[model samples]
Target: MGTAPVAVPHLPVGSRLLVPVLAATGGSGRTTVAHLLARGLAAIADTVLLDLSPRLASSWPTHLAARRATGLAALPPDQPLTRTAVRAACAVEDTGPHILSDSRAWHAPPLLNLPELPAAWYQLASIGGWQAVVADTPHPLAHDLLTARHTGERALTRDWYELPYAIPVLCAPATADGVHALIRATKTLDAEALPLARTVVALTGTTDGRLPASLRTALAGATDRTAAVVHIPHDPRIRAQGQSTAHPRPRTRHASTRLTDAVLSAAHRMWGRPMPLAPQPAALP
Candidate 1:
């Protein structure tokens, strides 16, 4: 059921990128990877991270509270978000992209009550100076945002918002049901609906560095849409650190350091600059 680039041809200088880390299951570590990608990408280019999901128990913004100047709810729904407002509502990370915290004002349903999402996305896309944007998205908006993209509606206000974006789906590792559930979820987004260039699946929750044969086999069946498959080793530090506010640029724990590197490789591929000799992990089943 569940899930998984790179280039010497990089995005033009100063161009913006959005990498939305999504998940089929609620607690599959989507936010964790999103934060790591944001941090890693920040090392290469100016990055901005938007947390679109507030329902989760923990997130990067929560880990380090001082950076949170405000939440997404404060972005004035009636009008386009002003740059000043974006600054006020988001936690500004000096070394990385700015962050927009999740807001409870989200209303409901298919759109998860945050109907102003499209406009919010446009505002971020419109903002200049940022080279990358990483969004930790929930299930409801995945289809909506990609639908806009497929329909050619998600361009930045200035450049026609054709902002570059990727969708990383994190699925539970080792469980057939989890991968199968992911496969079922993939059925909802056909190749046309999915971001073929940037779509990737990461098998999370692992104690070992390798993935189980069963999970790998399932992912291989999704070769059509997935760009790659990666494994994120489980570490207690990541779990513990989730409770506190994190550095704007994430610092890896003792064991999870390699996990962060693996994720950064994924980020590089999604950005379209191929990693020369980048080791190809196992293919999705």
Candidate 2:
């Protein structure tokens, strides 16, 4: 979070934004940040949480009690997804963001890959008129990107990082090892000439109190390369119970609000205009 008070930034009317929760390591609190961002953003935008994690690894379906929804698998392979189709494939709850993720059991085989590219998923969300899409990208994708860069074959990397009006929230645990991994990932993205300037660094607290001296010293070197560096406070419940749709503690929500604000600040910088407020709903007679 920045030194100033967090300002709420709504999406400009008829505009959409893709906010991908990206990370270089697992257990860096990627999905939890994505969920919190989605829930917080839902108050101002038509938000959808796209759980791009593997089927057996997905948490939203179970957390939301939407185990039977089939999620991504329910979409037809031969057709372009319509609003109705996307809605049907999602775990449409009465509140919070709609979830579109693979909810299959641990033993299931690989599924079909229509909307083949990473950008295609964002397009589907746009087609469905979602104002915001928070994609919980698979953990391995970052490692793959780094590998591709090193191997001199990065043809497949653009769609994930180069989408129009997309904001990348880079997450990592607030630890010496975790910060080192994050720095490496950032350098990779920078070398590839992706929009690293628009990125947000989220340091998920692995423990309480001041950051480890080593981690602080590491982050100090890379602070200038990002939009904002926000600390996601460690939540004991999340650490103990994992992610669920239930409300988080107040401080956790505060951190989430800061992250959302940073994202909106980055979006404002990208688009260069003041965002319009969401319209008020009509009251019942």
Candidate 3:
């Protein structure tokens, strides 16, 4: 997707954030959460969404020249990475966030130490002053990062959760599996690492905006876990089958926008106060 990034004489002055959207199960709407989160964050920073998903983000480039953008694997194994290389590998989008996307990196073996290897490029991109990095990392990688969030400590053995104050956004359905996933995810929480003050977005994907009874009981009874659940109603567009039928649909843009707003509201709980969100982009013509 190698479209040049907006050039600046120097790195912008501001804080940075790394949001790796994760999921316990397939239908938890992980990709949807990622794209929406990226869009939501665009208003606050120069957002670079790393599309590590097997499939590309719907808004990313798929054109002739854009498709020629290189993947992470193409990075020189030894030389230091430069802004030019970073710019070359990513594609500029027509609206919202830009994406440093390379699906090939999805198959590489996981690296135990982060801020380097596969993540280094993007991590460096963040360091170079993009301000915000939202990675739609593979589920396995995402889940492993959750382990760091759950324990509040990085395992002595892995690179998970190495990002400072990294926000781990976990998406789950409103079914029995979502409940089971909720319990399994929160079993171990380090107050210092993952606090209960923030909001949790649990997308029910059901007509009624309610979680399953069992999951509700589990979450409600979780006195130690204070992260309140913010339920997202079912949007048929999220579950659409084909590329032609999916997200950004005019019929469901309103629904997706609603969810984006919920995520922004929850963000305030963790980040201290809400950052002004840029207006939602009109659907692509």
Clashes of 3: 4
RMSD per model, one decimal: 10.4, 7.0, 9.9
Q: Which stretches of candidate 1 lie over 4 Å from their true place?
A: 1-13, 55-61, 93-95, 103-113, 140-174, 191-197, 243-285
Pick the TM-score winner: 2
The residue-by-residue lDDT of candidate 3 on 1-285, one tens digit each, is: 898887422213355556666565676766666766666567556777775543333233332133566745445545666767766666555555666654243335543122323345435555345666776655443355556568786532133244543455667777777667655555433432544344344454545456657667776665235444545556665555421232465534554455545544555555555333222222221
lDDT string, candidate 2, 153-226, tens digits: 65334566766677888888888778888888787777778777789888899778777677687787766689
How does each model score on lDDT? 0.53, 0.75, 0.52
Instruction: Give candidate 2's error at residue 77 in angstroms.
Output: 1.5
- The order by descending lDDT is 2, 1, 3
Error of 3 at 265 (Å): 5.8
- Score candidate 3 by lDDT: 0.52
Worst 10 residues of 1 by lDDT: 276-285
**Collision pairs in model 3:** 1-69, 1-91, 112-159, 205-234
TM-score of each: 0.64, 0.85, 0.64
